[model samples]
Target: MALPTVPHLSQDGIAFSAVKNRPAYAIASVDSALLLASLLQQEGAMRVTDVAARLGVSVSTAHRLLGMLVYRDFAEQLPDRRYAAGPVLRRGPVQQASVARLREVALPHLRGLVEAVGETANVMVLAGPDVRFVATVESDQVLRVGDRTGRTLPAHLSSGGKAVLATLDDERLAAVVASLDAAVAVRLERELRTVRRRGVAVNDQETEAGLTAVGVAVPPSGGVTGAALSVAAPSARYSRDRLPVWKEALAEAAGGIARDLGDG
Candidate 1:
């Protein structure tokens, strides 16, 4: 019997068509990813041949596709080398620009975190070695970290940047920090090491005196989804040092968003 096909449903074709057409890494040929995705819907798991038969592609081609899936962690190979959904993924639509998708995936979590911390919560992504605040929800508190809806800050100077960089290997991390002055780069590397250990990044008067922020990197799947969840509070409100609360909240929120993007 023939396996069923993966539906070609476009959740927001008008908006996401451009992105869907472009492969995650800008590499050509998405036939395999689509085929694998189709196979996933038809069955809980699949082997290379199972996909090859349905897509009418050669088994060798299927093998190559499966290997790509393994590289990206979009599908996992069990001991038997059978594939399942690699991990959490951003799904449903593709026409959306990266920024739009980031907002959709992150806004709900950011809002919840803001409500929890009673301060502004933000979604920040690294843009050309700088951390850009793409989305934000201001806190209900009388004081806030700052009004930074679409502002960019030095990745070395912000909590979100540290969190994201901590997840990178030394070489990649160094490239980002190297762009800064020596003192700034050294301080950031030291802090990034601490972030890797503690699983959260803190910018206590580092970004700006009298402003404290906490964040955790959104375990990235590829690049567009690579961002961090952060909470910003006035030094006064954070005076008593609500570090633990924000740390837990940022991690939880980032995790939730990661799941939505298929990174969990």
Candidate 2:
């Protein structure tokens, strides 16, 4: 999840190693409240006693952690006082806390792209063999693509995934594609080739039936990065002829973001 780094932040701005080691720190903390919160994060919603037992802390310490999390909107205590991820935290689409700065940098521009294109716009990053939506701008169309923020789906069926994948050389790209089954790999190859040739990728009913999406890569970083910007519309309203328009708008938006990231 730390694979997608911050955009518009210089290399000196963040220590990549710090982010890579976050999970380890999350596991090693001895602070009772933090320990309680950590356990809840790993094992899902739990009663205060359950969290306390797992962390080997007293109920009072568990309560302290729950209170802190609730105050920070990072955890929610149910009516029964069982705890789960809170609304604000549950809404966190970017798993890499360090890279969340990228979202802040990209929001204004991404919203502008969505407005210009008159279609939904999404930003995503790789999650294993799939792509996870990190941000979205919903379409004004009455019939539109749905929000996929924080949701992961197979890369083979997503225009965004292909767009990002196209930037990789054949060796690395093949390795990424090979993680999937043969059929999925074949489709990825076909789509990625089109993405490479056209500088845009389109998904025509490959994800959900009657839903079409077009995308371009967001080169947030050079060499082996996996971030994409996508536009989606209902298939009933899409046409091959419209692809050129979509490609133009998408390329403009992606190019600007890529430039900003490179300068960083």
lDDT of 2 by residue, 145-248 (tens): 55455555677678887787888777867778777889878867886777788898887877665668898888755332577888887677789988998888
Would you give me the overall lDDT of model 2? Answer: 0.67
Compared with the true structure, all predictions reach lDDT values of: 0.66, 0.67
Per-candidate TM equals 0.60, 0.62
Find the 10 residues in a row with the least total lDDT in model 1: 13-22
Candidate 1 lands at a TM-score of 0.60
Deviating ranges (above 4 Å) for candidate 2? 1-98, 222-224
Candidate 1 lDDT over 1-264, as tens digits, reads 111111122222211110012233443348557546534532346788877885678999888887887788777777887776666433422222555567678888988998788888888777658676666776654334433544566777788877888888768777777778898778777777788888888777665545677889997653464478788765566753588778888889987887777752
